[model samples]
Target chain A: MSWNVGVWIASLLTLAIYSFLYKDNPFYKVAENIFVGVSAGYWAVVLWFDFTWPNLFEPLINRGNVISLIPIIVGLMMFAPLIPKISWLVRIPLTFTMGVAMALVVTQRIQGEIFPQLQATFLPLAGVSPGVLISNLLIIIGVIATLIYFYFSKEHKGVLGFGAKLGIWFMMIAFGASFGYTVMARISLLIGRVYFLLHNWLGII
Target chain B: MKQTLPLFIVFGCGFFMIIAFFIPLGGFQDVSQTFENWYTGVIAFFVFVGILNLVRVNTERIQKRTRDWQYSIILLIFLGIMMVAGFFIGGREGRLFLYLFDNFYIPLGATMFSLLAFFVASAAFRAFRARTPEATLLLIAAVIVMIGRVPVGYWIWHGFPSLVEWVMNVPNTAAKRGILFGADLGLISMALRVLLGIERSYMGGGKE
Candidate 1:
């Protein structure tokens, strides 16, 4: 098919979705459902080809690798649930596989998610400008306050209470800032798409 | 039956996912990796389940000719077509799939994500109203930070740039850390509740 025909189909589909902003309509629903179907199908294909086939099938069939058969058997165990009589067997593989995977992710996630963040908090106040000093102090203060705001069980009294209040304030500000940033990030992608329609696909530009 | 069972599971996953990091036990690495893989598979299964639910709901609505039943028909048609294309011809053989993805999917996803722009603008306009002492202070802080992040804002005020850096480095980071700590604490508490069978969110709801 010509790019022109493809662009026409795409543009119409996009417009159909945008019509959703006014109110829920048939066009938008069509677009939304198409999106969900396509994405799901794409994922299933990717997984089978990238993972189940190449890793398990190729190894077991071509190389006669026996250990590779273990995952394959364990994975196939997932279908045991389809057989009501053997449904409990499905849990064995599911739990074992996911349990190990979760442990692995958490171990790595702690370093990626927590460590750098914690390190960033150790701010040196001096040798920096007066503005920097005040800001750093505020950061330390805000963190304490926000943490307090989230505190449950214990009733925060006096200083802790005040800290919690500050935390809430800091949170709102942070959310507002983040909300603003997210807007720009989202808009840029939209602009890129629109640009494609007008210039690359349509050649109107 | 209720949503509680699912909530507990969510809490449990979040908790263990966090806890597994601190323990540093032998064999933890391999175990967690496997868990991650399983999580992905579980998520994929749910994706299909969700669609089944959608079709069920929409089909009922369409049969009744609900006020906007027309859209449901379109949805079904588009959905069926994509499912057929994907299952039969997905890889390079599914060149049509790639074509549709590039031409249709990317733009649609972009448009959905872009809705945030209008929402943010509306939110900011509301925030700037400064109805109270906190709001006023926040407005001031926001203005300072926004100007500081950008080159033009700093160019005009000069000091605004450095001021913005201080705001982010000190106050912003501290505040974020505090929130994270609180979130971590909450996750632990919730996880404990679930493990104890108080907060069942995953058993498809005996709500146990």
Candidate 2:
């Protein structure tokens, strides 16, 4: 086996974190804390370089842009929570974020997500192949029944109940499939680390 | 005054953004774009806020000599190292930053999430119980999907993958869409409530 120092370090850190799977220990705690600290620092760097510098600080310094000061102040206000007396000032930034996010989402969501999916649901049964046609029919039925299942306005004792029951079956199938897919994804990550350890660190390949 | 002012700000910002989307005029659009940039800038500071919170919590833990206080010291040391490397040397592109990130952060992150693989097996075992008709259907679907997605299922039967694909594309997509539509409508209503200042729980003290 041949390995570089970086690979050895990386492998050790990886194993330290994976030690949690066996049981929590000092090594796992150190690894977890290090990850948290490093990630936070990385994000802080990203924010400074990407948004704060380019959008706010640079503009104010270079162009004499006073408007940028507003955001800078509000942004600083986000740290108000660190102080007990003036912590309520944090609300300014939070409200701004929430308000803008809501506005953006409300406007774009219909066009971006809802309408596109709604349009997709209206599939051509006649022109498509038999398999596709059946799929389309299933999609239509499943969507309607699922919608009915979520509709809590009615008592759901008769026809609605039947539709809701069918919806549950469809939802269960979907959830199961989703869970299966997630398992596959997690396994892929595990495989990547295993590959790293075996090929890069131990050179067992 | 405190409560009312924040609500008004929320309403004003939300209302203006919604209007700006539809208007698309030069002057109005420019203002909207500026506000959007400011929003981005403000949101970026949230990283610092988060880091501050982390530091405060960890520092407090260490001061109290809480369980695993030594680990918090290790955390602060790494955090200080990374921050110094990032701020002084430069962010990820710097030699020290890249070295630490590549050696420590990436591997740890990958391994941490990869640990989910073990948990997933335990979760699957518990979740796959065929108690009711619905539960049986879920278990069956899960098993089929799991088997069909892999090479073993392909080797066992050529049709398994196709069957799995059909299941995923048809029923899965349908149910997801139905849930999304309902959920999004709920989201819109909630957003409206917040924008209108009816949802004051976000103001932290629940005084609205």
What does candidate 1's lDDT look like per residue over B1-208, in tens digits?
Answer: 2243334444455456656566678676555454465455444443454566667777998999887777667666656665666667665358766776776677677766665566666778866877876776667667776556667787788897776666555556677787776565455455445444564333321112
For residues A107-167, what per-residue lDDT tens digits would candidate 1 score against the true structure?
Answer: 4445665676677777898899986687777887787788778776588888878877788
Q: For candidate 1 chain B, which ten residues in a row score worst on lDDT?
A: B199-208
Candidate 2 i-RMS: 1.3
Chain A TM-score of model 1 versus the true structure?
A: 0.85
Worst 10 residues of 2 chain B by lDDT: B199-208
For candidate 1, the chain B TM-score comes to 0.74
Which regions of candidate 2 are displaced past 4 Å?
A: B206-208
- Top candidate by TM-score: 2
lDDT of 1 at B83: 61
- Over all chains combined, what TM-score does candidate 1 have? 0.73
